[model samples]
Target: MGQGDAPERTRRALAAAFDPVFYRTVYDDIARTGSDPLRHYAGTGWREGRDPAPWFSAAAYLSRYPEAAGGDPFLHYLDRGWRQGCEPAPSAHRERFLERIGARPHAVGAGPQAAPRAPDADLPAGLGRKAARELAATGFDAAYYLSAWPDVAAAGQDPLDHFLQTGWREGRDPSPDFSAADYLEVNPDVAAAGVNPFLHWLAAGRAEGRPLRFELGFRGRIVARLTPLEERVAAAAR
Candidate 1:
């Protein structure tokens, strides 16, 4: 979302990182009979298109290496290529490439963590004892029953399911369907301080006390302000 030219800069950077090998293998090879050594690589499997360079803007490259332009001769060439090639392009291929490459889950980078292993459906004996004792005083409330289940709720859906089905629940209001940002295609406002249309929709829904459906989806700024209803319910139980 930054500069429109940023993506091209990034693409050139990728090309530069790989350029040293690219130039040597495709351009400077003495064994080749023709002037275009790069043409040979392109004719073979090394180059992907009419462009003489290899494709480094893909997630496959990042997935195998676990870093953006892993520190190497190839990476150095890629960085330089990104700087040189992206200057002329006005469109946003670089940012799209970054997003695609960055989306892979990894513990090391800013990416999301690898999926956690599924927890045992039955609670451990000690955890079950602790949960039972914690809820002993608050008799017959599903919300109370849920309080002892922080570990499970942190796991997300399991607790949601248990809360929905269990009787005597105190907090029954469903958390609004703010996940709709995944569905809607909307444009951003031009003003620097403009309120996002998505946030306006969420506020309008909150004012009406109507649950947001999955399609209308929230833009997240409101979601941040509204304490997750689960935390509120959990606090009330305590």
Candidate 2:
């Protein structure tokens, strides 16, 4: 191929391997860390003595499974797809791919297996260990939740129960607070459509048949979306 053609070919190949979500994740990390994400991934420039062979090669291979290239499923397809450069596989096959890489598929609702019991012990008295552990597994800081809202505990309610029933229902800033309950409170027009907010969120996403980053936030003027615990739970149930 001609020299000019090489760059375009490489671009296409990389595009195939790394979807928008991959780029977004890298950019998000950069914003969060205030560092150069491309430098971390590919170095100075594509031709500035930084070897692009590995990434380009992986991209070429990943292009074959374009259907699995973005959002949540992208991670599931990445390693094996890069190494094997094969056609897309079913969920069962993907599970096996994880196994082949010495990894196990993550279980839904499974809390951190290694989190110390100390956090649970810090929960208000009368809350059971199981309930505390369940809240922690949901990815929120359990201790922070307790400390942030003492009134829930003072009423002798389980922290998780209060979170599901009330705390999440309260409104906050749109960015970083797009919980099902909060979203409904904020978007009364949507709520007026006469559907359950939580279910509507799930149904809309399902209809699109694509991964959504629900929790939105601004990092230095850039709007970023992230999947939250409530959405994760809804996804698991679906």
Candidate 3:
């Protein structure tokens, strides 16, 4: 194949190995931490018989965003060397598995949290904007954190504190407030807190046309929706 064709071929190969269902199973397994879902799923697949090379190669894709992949079930399979295509010795799987286990976090939820309280009407609107923008710019992965809330609460610190600690001004424009609307960007776990400043802001953002992404776990496949914030507000206002 020509050099140009090589890129397309490589992309296709990668796509085939990184199946969404497989990743979903992996994420679920990790969330459960060797729970029955993983055990039952593993029993159905010929994972052991497959070459460790592909699994490991796929894991490189997963490990690219370790935290994101932490929610999947294939992590164990990834550890077993089921990568995309990095050639490895047959015996290397055991060593890699041990290393992954040793380094993995005890739980993805434990971390420092910013401790800002609620946002009264007196608080400046600019504050929320500045904080959210900064959080977004600083590799904060706010969407993902919002999705995994409570479960991933400590990861982004207190969402309210996260909003208050920024440098925003309360201009006449009234910067948007966060709400349950924005929390839906990552997952529904965030809705656990009921109503908070972050949820309030998210609701406002939606009202003003900024929608959050909603990801659903369907039998291990991740399907997302750009849920209009307005819809969330209308629903809540009812």
Candidate 4:
């Protein structure tokens, strides 16, 4: 490779790892301008600590591997970071994604492990419309949903629609304490049935006392917490 080919090589590598739809959707300023997501990212996004996809958190990557600074995180990872066993998204599905990248190191930027997990953001709505609508009428928090998955907001799809259609199955969490992935992981029946996890919770999990996420559980209900609890239920609960 000639020195002149470096820029093109870099672009190709970044393009393989970068996700334009995720970029435009997650970041409001970019979405508002409707600029080419890749151009913006290559030009300024990485410098500003912007992530390429849900599986890759730029800020986290830089923090974890400060040596990756002054260049694109994806390039560093694809070139040698993965070989060094560098982590991408610490908060996302780290294990599964790690397996994916390790298995297909050359295809780092092709797509997230979304089909085995990611629904193509461009595909027409198919499965989750009704579940989404039903979820909408419930105490579904739109603000929280957007904050949790800014990509959803960027994609221009309704929050519930995305959740029911893609979010739940993809393991996108609906709230701070509720994990869509965990709910599905613990319940293969629900996963196989292809029912929305949150909807399943509302319809049956709540009655069945299904746990949400690993960290989302109540830790044996501390005695001090009882002071704030409703007295009527506290006595029996304790």
Candidate 5:
């Protein structure tokens, strides 16, 4: 084959390997636009809020033939069209593209096995896996402690540890605070009452079963969201 024929051959090979379902979905567009399906998808498939089929189909294609993908298949496909003289648009989809292909941002830690659990690990046992995943994605660690020991968790010390050591002492409310340490300094009444704020919050606040206010980090900004533990439990049940 001539040097110039190699890209066309590779393109043909990729077309033969394309998923049938994906082909049918975009076939009309391909025919109408007179474009190669693989190149078309390489340019447009892995976008957020679009149909996931194109992304998944591209992933399935790579998974079926590992050699074509080399060391990093997603990146390989991402740059393939551009390398063949297509415009450089795929780079813009880097984040979503990596996500679609299940690539991790960092290598998995090989440290101690008994390392401290992520805050989401403390999620109530009743929460279903889906709900737990959603909460974790939203960074709702405070809710776990709020449901378990509102005042103590709000007070900022480890809720379980503080509860075990001090028990319920009076005047220990970490009132209207961000961290347990902060609450301790500010809430003089709780300090004088000498009660375990953790236990007190559990009995008085948690028992009432109010929705917990927590911050959610979305799209690089923090937004407030209210969540009741019972709602999560119900979602789990469903």
Candidate 6:
């Protein structure tokens, strides 16, 4: 990425905004190919109308701003489209999402949503234990959960057991990058059904490409997808 002037500036800004892990996790096909996520998106994925992140939809944005068709929709959004009140998703949904994000309480450990959850006795045996196990193997962070909820940590609870019993309904996050409120907000059905949001996502959402949380903490796992020569150039500059 030995770039200069306006193009390079945009590239770096987009790189900063990009989340390689989020891209790969959302699209298993991209992960399966082992291509650098940003490289793919910059080169062809965007042209294919693929989204760069969960919060931004390329095709949807393009539909709103056809003038942006000549350039990358993600770049355009970061560049100026958002200032123009562009939406990355359906207008109504995006409005709600923006309001939720702005409120901030929708984040970890905010307590059970306004809606109640089924009592512990009503939960199936090992409700989210399986999903929790699978996510742990993939990227779930139980320690993060405890850290977010001091009471749970103070009580020396088994992180998984507590989450299965009460933590989720209380809006406790299982992983730092996953927000129960964010998931439920986008997926009202999961919230309505009383199914574990994380479980529903793991068992079904992954295949469906349903939206979920992408915490700000892990924004750039691998966005700098420059070639080896470019890497050397960047390292030399550093």
TM-score of 1: 0.16
Model 3, 1-238: lDDT tens per residue?
7877865754444333333323333344434655343344335432433222212432443445444343332433333223332232322343343334342233456568734656644232444555554533443344544454443355646543444443122111112333334343222222322233343344344455433432213212312343468988999999
- Distance from true location, Cα of 89 in model 5, Å: 26
- Superposing every Cα of model 5 onto the true structure, what RMSD results? 22.1
TM-score for candidate 2: 0.24
Model 2: how far residue 1 lies from native, Å: 26
Per-residue lDDT tens digits of candidate 5, residues 1-238?
8989876765554444343333434345555666655565546643321222233333443455455443334344433532332221223233443433343233467565645654333334355445544433332244454565666756777643443344223333222332443333333233334433333333343465421321111211211343467988999999
* Cα shift from native, residue 56, model 6 (Å): 13
lDDT of 4: 0.65
TM per candidate: 0.16, 0.24, 0.19, 0.39, 0.18, 0.40
Q: lDDT of each model, Cα atoms only?
A: 0.35, 0.41, 0.38, 0.65, 0.40, 0.68
Best by TM-score: 6
lDDT of 1 at 205: 29
- Report the lDDT tens digits of candidate 2 across residue range 1-238: 7877865654444444432323333234445766554444444332222212222222432355555444223333333333344433322232333333233434667777844554333333344556644533444444556666777657877765565445544631112323545555333334434333433343353454432332212121132344677998999999
Candidate 2 weakest ten by summed lDDT: 214-223
Give model 5's TM-score versus the native structure.
Answer: 0.18
What lDDT does model 2 reach? 0.41
Off by over 4 Å in 5: 23-39, 46-238
lDDT of 4 by residue, 1-238 (tens): 8989887876676766565645775677997988899999888887877777656777788889999988887678766677576867742433443343342234556765645533432222242545546654475777799987888899888986777666766777676666667786555456555666777777677788755643211223233354554776778788
Superposed model 2: Cα runs more than 4 Å off = 1-141, 172-190, 193-238
lDDT digits (tens) for residues 1-238 of candidate 6: 3545778777777886675655776667888989999999899988877777656777788887899998788899776666566667632233343334352234555755564554632333354555455554465577787788889889999887788667777888888777789888666556655677766676677788867844332233233433578778998999
Stronger candidate by lDDT (3 vs 6) = 6
